[model samples]
Target: MDHAPRAPRRPAAPGSPPGGDERVRGAHPHAEPGAESDPDRAGGFPRPRRLPERQTVRDQVLGALRGALLSGELCPGAVYSAPALAERFGVSATPVREAMQLLAREGAVEAMPNKGFRVAERSSRDMAELAEVRALLEVPVVLRMARTLPAARWEQLRPLADATVAAAAQGDRAVYAESDRAFHRALLELSGNRQLVAVADELHRRAQWPVTEDHGCARPGAAPARGTSARLVTDATQHAALLEALAGGDLAAVESLVRGHVCGT
Candidate 1:
């Protein structure tokens, strides 16, 4: 769905207008019976308050926990204990449990048979599968965006790409992950379908294990031959090629390059 447009800003009434001092019936009631009162309303400004029907506390907790998992702050082989999370997030255990259950449904965390939720583990095979899935979904999106999106928006990606390169140069894995995520998001946004963009986002989130593994890109269980991303010049070259394809609007080459780059990486 298209985003709702923001309401037009009301013209400022000459300056700092206060509340509740409108000239009701053309008489200055606040002034002593007959004196000219300040036209600006005073005494009735609305106070800010929480809405009863806004997102539940559990939802907020769930979002925070998911963000933590995605950012690699909460490593695999760790437990997401409700009481502990509650203490961390300044909420009650009830909301924490609800949030953990939500994360479990999304496969970000797993409920242990005997206890709390554990950070879900992804093996080398899982990484390979995720890379394949990402390639399938993202490559075409970039191709399409390159073909149809405004040149202005396409140009906007250069800074994001530069940031990614800088992060890589400095070995700032965290910044690198974010800039990489932003660059792809901009590409996917050009698809002009919120639903499709959301689908790609979910895929990106799931593929994070393989793409930017915090515990180390390839561990004991991972292998280079399983179609998982390579960690050398191949990765850099593929990304450069992907960027070039986008720059050139090579729609036909988009899918294959994306697949090759991701799988190559």
Candidate 2:
């Protein structure tokens, strides 16, 4: 009796390594142990990974919303519903609402009755006033630190300052804002005043609110328009200069740089 012919083997997927059995096994031969296998990897249609639930989702959504706000993707004075934002983020509405509530507390957005949260619309006067307040609070403290903070301590902050410059060069407003804030916070921490650092950080966040076309402020003696890549790079480079001033104990330069950095002068 003649035996039935053996079935032909399935062909290897395109881009697969020669002699590899990844298509049959549903995973790469060199894949990490315990890594999830993609059933459709050979077809180039890998499934999307689900976000973690609860606090992780809430924190991630909050960070994403904050980035959007800083990058001007979430426009000022516009309302965004929690359900809509949740859909956009591929998360449940519960976490989106929680994140929006936190933003409301931070004064980044305000809740509307029976509606969604509205992005805070801060005027030019508001930004100028916040900047003046920040200058009043920060300049003197930084000047004091300049005289006493050790060079090594100031040197430690160079990375944060460099991060701001890199972010500015890339024109990523969100990353630049965060790096700038981290640099200032690290600088102020040398003053040994936790309360001052906290207050100054809040002021910095408020001052960073995106200004609409009708409410823009031009920096004194700066040729580039506000929020432009040139303006951001100019602002970012000051962090390194300020660190150098602090390290060298140049009180006048420290004071002037701090004031100009905060007040946009």
Candidate 3:
């Protein structure tokens, strides 16, 4: 049978908006069709949409604090007042205080009766303990998933892994931390155990909290190495190696990789 000639493709006019199969920038990949038309469905998986007025303030404040903590801007031993943070973030003190209360509950910060919140300091022992807990919970689950989950699942997760590498290469500590979290969380979620994922996530966050002492050392008040971004680049390599080990069903290698990652040599 004869076929009609396909039309030549043409470039969009400058300043024209995307249409007809061109994805809108930042559109959620997992959103169901027509989700944009429904207010209730505007939010994407893993992140909430613009929240209600009251909740939006809390979210913004909390997010800002979390970023500061992960990026080492809020060092251990620093006492930060809610008003100061509010001024920094251009928000009200109430939301900042509310956010600090949540962080206190998470053990990321401590409430000071008259003074505001102080970043919680972790000892080497504390980090070691956190790593032990993480290993006890996460290692077996990940090994099992490595053996049972179809290879396609690992393939599907490559983008998240790549995101970690990209974030690390950019040397953005907060972005790397978040992308790293998403990579691990996506891996653990494959086990279909919500409670395990939740507990493991908390342990992960606690382990990453700023330490008063150098990692793996007894000395108090030691600083983290200046090569943190370089270390993350190494970590990205390990993440790729881990995927290879998993794809090969090497349980021993998987366990070793998991332990090294959790313990942070």
Number of the top candidate by TM-score?
A: 3
Assess the local accuracy of residue 171 in candidate 2 as a C-alpha lDDT between 0 and 100: 73
RMSD of each: 14.3, 14.5, 16.2
Question: Highest lDDT among the candidates is held by which one?
Answer: 2
Compute the lDDT for candidate 3: 0.80
lDDT (10s digit) by residue, model 3, range 1-265: 9999998766665544555355566567677777776666654544356856555789878887887776566777778898988888898899999999999989999999889999888888888999999999998889888878877777777888888898888776667778888898998998999999898888887777757764222123343223267888888767777888888888899999988988886
Clashing pairs for predicted structure model 3, backbone only? none
Estimate candidate 1's alpha-carbon lDDT, on a 0 to 1 scale: 0.64
Write the candidate numbers in order of decreasing TM-score. 3, 2, 1
Q: Which structure is stronger by lDDT: 1 or 3?
A: 3
Q: Global lDDT of each model?
A: 0.64, 0.81, 0.80
lDDT of 2 by residue, 29-71 (tens): 5555444544634334456768776658899999999887876
User: What TM value does model 2 have?
Assistant: 0.73
- Compute the lDDT of residue 64 as modeled in candidate 1: 74
Per-residue lDDT of model 1, residues 18-137, tens digit only: 653334454434445424342433233233556688899998887677656654566687775788779878989999898888778767788876578898887777878877887777
State how far residue 190 of model 3 sits from its true place (Å): 0.3
Q: State residue 205's C-alpha deviation in candidate 1, in Å.
A: 0.3
> Candidate 1: TM-score?
0.58
Off by over 4 Å in 3: 1-55, 214-227
